[model samples]
Target: MRLDELPLLTVLIVLPLVGAAVVWALPRAARARARTVAVTVSLLELVVAVAAAGAFDTGDAGTHQLLETHPWIPAIGASYAVGVDGVALLLVLLAVVLTPLVLLAADRHQGGTGDRLQHYLALVLVLEAFMVAVFAARDVFLFYVLFEAMLVPVYFLIGAFGGPLGRWAAVKFLVFSLAGGLIMLVAVIALYLQGPGGPQGFLTDNLTGLDLPVVGERLMFLAFFLAFAIKAPMWPVHTWLPDAAQNATAGTSTLLVGVLDKVGTFGMLTLCLPLFPDASRWAAPVIIALAVVSVLYGALLAIGQQDLMRLIAYTSISHFGFIVLGIFAFTSVGVQGSALYMVNHGLSTGALFLVAGFLVARRGSQRIADFGGLQKVTPVLAGTFLVAGLSALSLPGLSTFVSEFLVLVGTFARSRPAAVVAVVGVVLAALYVLITYQRLFTGPVRDELATTRDLSVREVWVVAPLIALMVVFGFYPAPMIDLVREPSLVTLDQVGVPDVPGGTVVDRAADGGTDDGDDEGSTR
Candidate 1:
């Protein structure tokens, strides 16, 4: 690549590190200085991401753009390869967009006169850098490295700044993540052993050639899937999320749930489909069944939650189910819709967290019962919450509704029964979000909460952009579709799914048919 074409990937990864170092070197006494520096760095990263998105060609939707490659471990044939397709670019953009918002949210708690606040700001900046890198890294090892490296900042964020459960929540989060990483490690090693040519080992390039025996592929695929599923926090494995989220401060919860958790779904799309297509095909039914269960289970649990933070946590699991279902469905619309869901979900959910954080700061509690008639005292805040909640529940004209609708439509084209069941999830979501809004915001102001004030100008700034983007993207998603169509096509072929005009539309069981990778929705 020409010097002018130098991959933006390294820039995306490096900018936050530079921001972090600058924050650290600044005098610990300079809390304002550190926050200033961190916010600037995050916004700059956002600009770069937007530029990268502009550079992408919507027409060549499937190709990786702004590519770069350099040999990192010659002996093992591994290289530091990084690039973004439309789907990856969308995720990269979401990470970039949320970083500044996260920093802004963190600023709300920095009002206390303490020098130690600088360290908190610095860690958030460093985490932003790693978050961007995680989405952009094409090399599996590089991806894994960033994945594991990100835990430290968040661990400290929660442990140091969280509520009474800080230490316990942090430890639980790490234990779950580390255990999953080790499982994936073994799979990565096994993949290296099944090298494409000679003993060169498992660089993604080489592994692309060695499809591996079906049995071995299935085993390794499950290993990686297990790790990512936990991160995705799917139904059975999602228990960690509610505790961690509830214990952490709002800013910390925003980043953890908004950007970091997405790493799991990204892995499934970028790694699993290309490396273990056959196994992915073989496990399709079970995965889809699990995804459907998550949708219903999470929604039901979310509806019953008394704590707002935990309610949001359970709701996220439900949202993740939509993304997973889209991926396993294997249709182009399903895959692309899944990717879009990632971005849209980040915006809506992140906004909710920030808004909730504002409430928590005011009332010093997260209990739904602790809030009432917030609409009267804090109408702006209540309105913001309503918008975000509606969007989260996939209200029409919002970004999430478009993606969720497309996902069900795509899945239905292949498996009508599965689509019917998933639609019930939509109704459940509406019930939870609307009822929560009514009970918390519309009722008569309680004596305690009535004293609560509306969001200040600065707090409003923190959430406005996120809510705006949620609406902007909802009505005009065609640009996003054009950008990712090609990549989704490439992934579909990789996973043994044949491409039709919109996506694969199959009439019967996808497994019994020829395994030319057609019938992408085999999981249905």
Candidate 2:
């Protein structure tokens, strides 16, 4: 079959489902093989994702590629519609790449046979399936279903394999997600009613360009953005993240905070902006303000964190703020940087969690004070942690630095003051990372951890790919840049915002083509 003719996306989605079943069905004698099964399945998923990349055309990255639409629920205008643009494609790839590493790095001997090892691995496989589908879903309702559906595997991952407060964290996460989902459901139904009614009315293409009442438009945008913001876990709605991250296992946190959390900003760029352009523009200033606040707030909190897991979680909040700021900046550079930052943050932060997990596993503690002078005992672990930490701070020449720099440059063009304030976040980032590293790896050697083993070969494998990717992308980011450019332009075009010369944002509706304005939203 031709590349386009092949049901590549369905295969991508179903492969994991099959893998989940296979792993779960393993006999008791063979239950230990669950990790093997999961590893193989995730690697296969990565291969399929790479294949999709090979088949994709970067020059036409703006348009959805590899579409597979089929009627699902005729009554509600829902369909099994899915596709990927450059933005979605990159995120899908990130999900795939990270899954294998997580499975490989998972502590197999923790609970032994009774730990339901099969179940944990199976849930991860299931989460992978949803991760791909949610990013690929072109229909609004399908996207919503996948959006809310993801909470299932993640909920279990935290609850089943987490710490003392695991179940409570899971419940809180569910409550928050369901609350947002319910609100989005109302907006989703209202959205379909406002569209051209038909079997595929809920498709994003069909729903775009709707001329609704001003109040209605903003409300829908608010509902959708609220859902995304909560998922993205921005400022006010971000409380659940630290709790969830703290309770979950390292691998779980890696996927939860690193991969799943990105769905929020992705929704903002793809769904909110394209479908509700005017509302997005109208809400820009307030969103940018919140984004800046999240950046500062998360960083400040990170610097003061005693628990390593919570610190990482807080750092992600700050990173996500940068992402939202970039998306709302309404510049090609900003959006592109935001898009790329999503991938970079996943790599850097995910590795941080994994390495921290390695340390926690050895020392049996997640507290910063629990570790000290480990650089001499476990030089390799110390080194890997440092690399991940430096990446967190967006050290020059790292992959994160490239993305973070782009976001700043792009935002500076539109909102210098906001960008200026965000720079304070950059300074705070350095402090938090350095302080954490100093406490964990420097000073007098801890007598208790004197014999702590360095990273084993398997542990090395888990972080090697992540570290290598960061280094490769750090020096050469052209491929990522190409992937994000077209979609950035597409989002800009859909929002009806003209790129003004000299960093000004020209509102076609507001200025009537004559007046120039900075991102007025940044000020508010």
Candidate 3:
């Protein structure tokens, strides 16, 4: 079959599930074989993702590509529809790319040997399938189903494999996630009730043309936004993250923060703005305010964290603030930057979590004070930590910098005050990362840390892909930017906003001019 004719997305979604089933069906003594099968299957999924990318029409990034559809519930107007826009494609690839690395990282689970290992690997694959499906779902109902279903494997992964606090963390994660899902369910139902009656009512395209009552639209927007914000884990609702991250395995943390949490922002971009344009606009001020608060608040908390995993978790909260900021800025550059940020954050933060996991495994503790002068013994590991930390801080030569710069520049065009305040988070980020590095990797060597070894060959191979992507995308972001541009423009169009010309504010401020008298065309 031709590439476009193939049910490539369905295969991509189902293959991991099939692999999971196979792994579970293996004989009890085939532990090693299970590991091999899991890795091999994950790699195969990655190859499928690449093929999907290869067949994608980059020039037409706004439209969904390689769509597969079938009616599942004609009575309620729902279907098993799947497709990928540029944003969805990139996130789908992120989920596929991270799963194999996470499996490799978790190869030696601290919990069990034979059956437990197989179970853990199987859960990861199942989670991968759900994540891919969440991004690819063309029908809103399908998206919500996949979105809630993803929590199942993650709950098991954390509760079963995480540390002593695992069970509690898992419960907390479930509570928060389920609460969000329930709220979103209300919104989904209300949307359907208000939508044009047809088999396509649940589809995003059909939902976009909806014209709900003014108050109802705002209420629905809140339902969806609250759900996504909790998933995004913004500010006050973000307490579950540090607990979940600290307790879960590094690999679990990687996928949890890197891939799954992104669905929240992805939902915001795909569903919230387009489906409720007026509500989105009405809600932007409050959302942007909370996003800025999350930036500073999360960074401050990261600086105060003693546990490495919690620290990384807090940094993600901070990074997500930037993402939400860009999305709300309602400018093309801001939206595109936010999209790229989703991908780059996955790579950089995934690396950080995995490296920290290695360190914690060696030191038998997550406390920053437990290790001192680790550079003396494990220079390579320290170097890895440093690079990942630099990426977290959006260092000049890393992938994050390009995306973050665009976010700031784009936000500046729309709101100078918000941009300036958000920039403070950058300084705080540097402080947090540097202080953590100094405490953990610098200072005099501790007796306990002296025996710590460098990264294993497997560990090196696992991290190399993430590190390489950081540097590669850092220097050459054109391909990714190109992929995201059209989607960003589409978002702006949906919101009835136009891109504010770059440097308009800067030029005005430099000339000692104000918005009071300048013509709009002159500013453009």
Candidate 4:
């Protein structure tokens, strides 16, 4: 078969699942071998993902590449379909790339060994497969199935392997997730019922073109948006995240916040806007308002957090607020920025969580007040923490700055008041990060902390890629920006909104001339 004809996506989704099965089948006594196998398999999956990325046609950013389809559940008009556009590909890469790092970062104390070691590894691999499938699914039904199903391994990873309150946190996470899933299920069924009634009816393209009653469309939009917002963990519905993050292992928290949580905003981008353009626009103001509130509320909460894990979780809430804000603004820069923010947030937040996990492991506590003058004993750890913290604060030299800047500028063009209010979150971010750093890493060295060691070679390897990517993308974000441009335009077109001139003008002017570069100056 030709390269494009190969079932690359299916392989990408199945490989880890198969690996999980193999890990599970191993003798329980072979926990060491199982860890090796799991890590090796994750590495192999990352290689496959990179090969797929290499083959992706970046020049044609609007179309899904390497499309694969087969008949599955014809009774429900659902087919086994998968493909990747720039947006999907980026997310897939994120999932694949993070899985291995998370596995490698796993230590015995964090529930990486024992009789359940194989089970933990298997569940992580299974979660990886579902995450890839969720991002790659071209069929709406398939997306929803994988969307809810993705929760299974995560539930186990947390409830079975997490901290003292793991089971309770897991239950809370599941309850919130299931409530959202139920709401989305109603909307999905209603949408399918309203369709022309065939296999094609379940496809995203076909569903996008459907003409439904205004009230029906709005209701469906709410169903999907509510689910996504909760997943995004927007304020009010966001309480579960702090508990979940605090209780889960750092590696688990990394995947939960970095990759899985993204599914929520991803749904908003891929499902809500395209499938219900009028409803998206109709609901933009309210969503933007909520997003702004999340930005401030999350930041304020982060500053007050006593637990390091919970603090990082709160920061994600703030970051996600910016992402949702950009998505709803309906401007080219805003949407593209949100897309890029998804990628950047994964890297930065994943690093912070992992580092925080290391600190907790060393100090035997997650409380910020437990450590003082850590820089005197473990300079490397303190330095790594500083880098990750600065990145979270959107330091200008980091990858986050570019995306966050775009989101703010884009929102400013569409709604100055919203953008202005969102900017306060930035100041709050700096306060939280610096204060946490000061509380833990600064001050006189304590005799107890003097024995604490710095990062190991393995730990360094885990964080090295994330730090490198942040710096590289910070200076040169064009490649990612180019990939996101066409998708943003397509979304703007669906929403029937022209590109806001202020965004375009500011972007162009910042680049030092009127030339529009590879995007051709068109926002749909």
Candidate 5:
């Protein structure tokens, strides 16, 4: 719990900001130099993050570690508090890991390298800083600042380097994000005004500890949930996502869909439940229904997509459905499943986007119909896409399988009908992913793409680890399971849900779970 021990979180957030500054300060002629600097900084940040994870005590994750809290705006009772339980730590690690890979992927494609590359790298680094902050911030206001601020860089990313419709996509994305952010901001203000201790104002930990009135609680909860839903891009609000992804460059699309989008669901699991337990319980069934609908709906849309990147975008909607499903299941298994799925989905889908980007860069087309017999033209590219595709489908021996299975199992314990409907999502995922593979990678070789090469050395290096980790974690998820077990249990308790005994961690009939933070002596 020493400051040095907690330096990981600090460095994870700061390094990216520093990188952004460096990128921005670079000479106009040093585009390549700027890229190099951005990559180096991100890689260093990733290393520090990994080292911190190596030192983390998984068994004692219920309680915060490397805890740092200090007065920021003391007048309003806001503080610069930051720490990580198991779930937060894991996500922090995942965000760090993906960033360098994103930089590498960006470099390999060299898509928008002239005047725009520096800005792109800077924006990405800034986004990374916000991402780490979101995972680490212990104060409600700090989290909200980071949450909403995360969108700015992405807005520039899509608008600057995306497809022919990039400008439109960026504008749409900003409008939706602004609308959600403003609503959430109003809710935050309300919470502060009415919070316990009178004028002491709001802090996440303190807010969760307060006993607000039921009606007030539900409204606050809905405010937060609506914002997260839009970010999660659930069903009705999900249209923006596909357009943004389709318009973005391969690397930007990969990072946007893979990592940034998880912020919505992450906020739900970490902030909403802890701060508004009763409201969450009351809204559980409705949220679960929406989750199932997102699953089926996202999948159907993905199945019918003619655009590869857009298809990947729709798949995220479906994947997020599982995350939402897990959150509402009110079980430790479900919660942990959702958290792990968040990380797993990032790796698998990020790789898929990377591969798709590679294809689009080579073929200069986004349409699936434009791709034909890619396996014949470039076997390595085909194989990489296959691995990413299988992982997306939650195939056995891939990272997503464990999490997706846990979500369904936990959900079934509480809502059999919802779980049954969700199962169809799994089947649909297989169809969409496999059909995409068949149509794009397995058809007759196209004359235009015959000379297209397989993944380059840097490309392989960037994605190889992701694919390997997916398989490694898929078959042996015990380490990850242990990482979030107690934190998730605490989260479930915060949501006023009972824990399931034995294999599962949710009980539908009772609100009984342990979040006493009593196990302080457990080893990593």
Candidate 6:
């Protein structure tokens, strides 16, 4: 069969589910083979995602591609619909890419329930399928279902397999998520009723640009945005994350914070802006303020955290703040930058969480004060940790720097004061990263951990790809930036926001130059 003819996205979603079922079906005697099976399945899923990317029509990547729709509920205008635009495709790829590495990082000791490795691995695979599905969903109902359903595997991953306080953390995570999901559900039903009633009424394409009532539009927008914000875990609603991170396993935290939380931001761009254009523009100022607060609040809290896991989790809140800020900024560069930031953040933060998990496992503690001077003893572990940390702080040569620079410049072009205020969070970011690094890795060798071992070959394999991608993208972000450009323009067009001459649309009048990079003298 031709690549285009193949149901690649469905397969991408289903393959892991099949893998999960296979994992669960493993006999008691065959439990030991579970890890190998799970890893192999996740790798296959990644291969399929790459194939989909190859077949993707980059020339017109802004529109949904490889779409599949099967009438799921004809009565309410819902369907089993899925597809990916450039940004959605990238996020889907992120989910598949992280699954196997996280699985490989899971050690035998992490098998909390007796012979529960298979169940745990199956849960991971199930979560992977949902992650891909949620990002790829085109039907709002489908998206909402997957959004709430994702909690199942995650709940188990945290509550059953996590650390000492895992149960409490799991309950907290559930409460916050359920509350958000419930609000989004109401918004979804209302949207369906207000939309063209048919088999596919809930499809985003069918609903976009509807002439929603002035008050209703804003209300629904709030309802939908509330769910996303909580999921994004921004500012006031972000309290659940650190606790979950503290109790859950490294792989769980990596996927949960790194990829899952992005659903909220992704929903904003895909649903909020396009579906309620006027309301989005109206609410932009208020949302920007909240996003900036999340940025500073998260970074400040991260600095003060004593637990390494909780600290890393808190940093995600701040990073997400920048993403929401860029999206709400409503400029082409801002939207594009936020999209790229999502992908890059997944890479850097996933690596950081995994490495930190490894360190805690080896040292048998999550407290920052537990050990010091690890660099002299374990150069490799220390080195990888440092690279991940540097990426977190947006060091000039890393992937994050490029995206962050775009966000700030884009925001400045539209909202200079907010941009200026957000920059303080950037300065604070440096302090948390440096202080944590200094306290944990640098001082005189601690007597207790003087003989500590370095990263295992498997651990090195887990981190290498993420670090290499960060370095490569740092130097050449063109490809990544290109992926988001067409979609960014479409988003801005929806919001009726023109790229003010300086950044997004390019200030050819000011510079006396055209967008054609080589034409220094050419102008309109």
Candidate 5 residue lDDT tens string, 1-524: 65346667777788899889989888777777877898899889988887777777777988887667777887877788888888888888778788878887785343477667778888888988888888889888888888888878888888877888999999999999889888998889878876764223556767775678878888988999889989887988888999999998888877787888888998898878888877787788788889999999999999999999899999999999999999888877788899899999999999999888888888778899998888987899899999999999999899999999999988887777888999999999999999999999886788888888988998898889899989899988888898888988888666656656554423342322233453332111
**Clashing pairs in model 2, backbone N/Cα/C closer than 3 A:** 285-521
Error of 2 at 13 (Å): 0.6
Q: What is the C-alpha lDDT of each candidate?
A: 0.82, 0.90, 0.90, 0.89, 0.83, 0.89
Q: In candidate 1, residue 300 scores what lDDT?
A: 97
Candidate 6 wrong stretches, greater than 4 Å: 503-524
- Give the worst 10-residue stretch by lDDT in candidate 3: 506-515
Candidate 2 RMSD computed on C-alpha atoms after optimal superposition onto the true structure: 2.8
Q: Candidate 1, overall lDDT?
A: 0.82
How large an RMSD does model 6 have?
Answer: 4.7
Q: Tell me the lDDT of model 2 at 97.
A: 95
Q: For model 5, how big is the CA root-mean-square deviation?
A: 4.1
Q: Give the TM-score of candidate 2.
A: 0.96
Candidates ranked by lDDT, best first?
2, 3, 4, 6, 5, 1
lDDT of 2 by residue, 130-241 (tens): 9999999999999999999899999999998898899999999999999999998999989899999899989999999999778998999999999999999899999999
lDDT of 5: 0.83
Clashes of 3: 0
lDDT of 4 by residue, 444-493 (tens): 98888888999999999999999999999999999998889999988888
Give the runs in model 1 whose Cα sits over 4 Å from its true position: 1-4, 108-113, 197-202, 500-524
Q: What is the lDDT of residue 309 in candidate 3?
A: 94
RMSD of 1: 2.7
Candidate 3 local lDDT, 1-524, one digit each (tens): 88878888999999999999999999876766887899999999999899999999999999999999899898888989999999999999999999999888875544256888899999999999999999999999999999899989999999999999899999999999999899889999999999886887798878895768989999999999889999988988999999999999999999999999999999999999899987887778778889899999999999999899999999999999999999998788889999999999999999999999999989889998888899989998999999999999999889999989999988888778889999999999999999999998898899877888999999998899999999999999999998999999888778665557755543222222234664554312
Task: Give the per-residue lDDT digits (tens) of candidate 6, residues 1-524.
Answer: 77877899999989999999999999888888898999999999999999999888887878889889999988888899988898999999889989999988888546444367788899999999999999999999999999999999999999989998999999999999999999888889888888897888999989998889989998999999999999998989999999999999999999999899999999999999999887887788888899999999999999999999999999999999999999988777889889999999999999999999889988999999997999899889889988998999899999999889989988888787889999998999899998998888898988989988899899999999999999999999887777789999888777665566545343322221224554332221
Total backbone collisions for each predicted model? 6, 1, 0, 0, 3, 0
**TM-score per candidate, in order?**
0.94, 0.96, 0.96, 0.95, 0.94, 0.95
Error of 5 at 364 (Å): 0.6
